[model samples]
Target: MTDIKTPKTWRSPAVDIYETEAGLTLIAELPGVERDALDLAFDRGTLTLEGRSDDIGYQRRFRIPEHLDAEEIAAELKDGLLTVTLPRAAGARARKIEVTVH
Candidate 1:
């Protein structure tokens, strides 16, 4: 008799997104996932997160807008919680300008 093994399934982590005047904040719950096992990437205006632990796998993806500065994106992981901050591009920030008559 031959034994068959099944491939592990990826689970989507719980995510929360909030919009502020300066930028967007994303929080994800990735229990049991360690920093060394986590992979974060930004490509073609899309943000991807992947992680794996001994018992579970976590994955999430979000489409990033052009107004957000991908180069300035930052992420932090602690206590099984991951926080990603996407700051708005300089051209995207709202600024007030005084109008002058010629």
Candidate 2:
């Protein structure tokens, strides 16, 4: 019998999303992925992340909210963990209103 090789499959990395008054934050666990191999992009209202290392790779996508600023998005990778921060637009941020007692 001849040996047959199967194609490798790519799996979505584990991710955690949090929303705060300032903006949204996404944390993904990508073990074995190198810092230079990661890619981040925001277009229209969609956010995507992809990276690869050896036989393991990660891919994930999210729909960004209208309040968030796509141009100001930033990302950092450390200790196999990727952290992406999306800041809220100037007008979208929450403002505290002072109360006056007469």
Candidate 3:
């Protein structure tokens, strides 16, 4: 009798998203993936990431917040990790206003 207790494989890529006062950050783990193999696209309010590593391929899509500035999207790949930064839109940036004393 063979013991079949191995964990099931997952088909989706591993990713993490974080939101801060200044912007939103996305991190993805892509082992064996070359920098040139990665592809990123943003349309409307959606951000998509697709890539292939070794024999594995991955695709992920995220719904970006309206407060985020899609024009300032930036990405970096280092140590098998991809980091993307999306700055908040102009209206989302924090501001201070003074009230006139009566």
Residue-level lDDT of model 2, residues 1-102, one tens digit each, is 112222166889999989898898899999877767777888779998888776666788898989888889999999999999999999998899999999
Could you estimate the TM-score for every candidate?
0.86, 0.85, 0.83
Q: Which of the numbered candidates is closest to the native, going by highest TM-score?
A: 1
Q: Write down the lDDT of every candidate, Cα atoms only.
A: 0.88, 0.83, 0.81
Best by lDDT: 1
How far out, in Å, is residue 17 in model 3? 1.2
lDDT of 1 by residue, 1-102 (tens): 112222187799999999998999999999877788888999998899988876577888899999999999999999999999999999999999999999
Candidate with more favorable, higher lDDT: 1 or 2: 1
Q: Can you list the residue pairs that collide in candidate 1?
A: none
Candidate 1: give its CA RMSD in angstroms: 5.6
Please give the ranking of all candidate structures by TM-score, highest first, separated by commas.
1, 2, 3
TM-score of 1: 0.86
Model 2 off-target regions past 4 Å? 1-7, 99-102
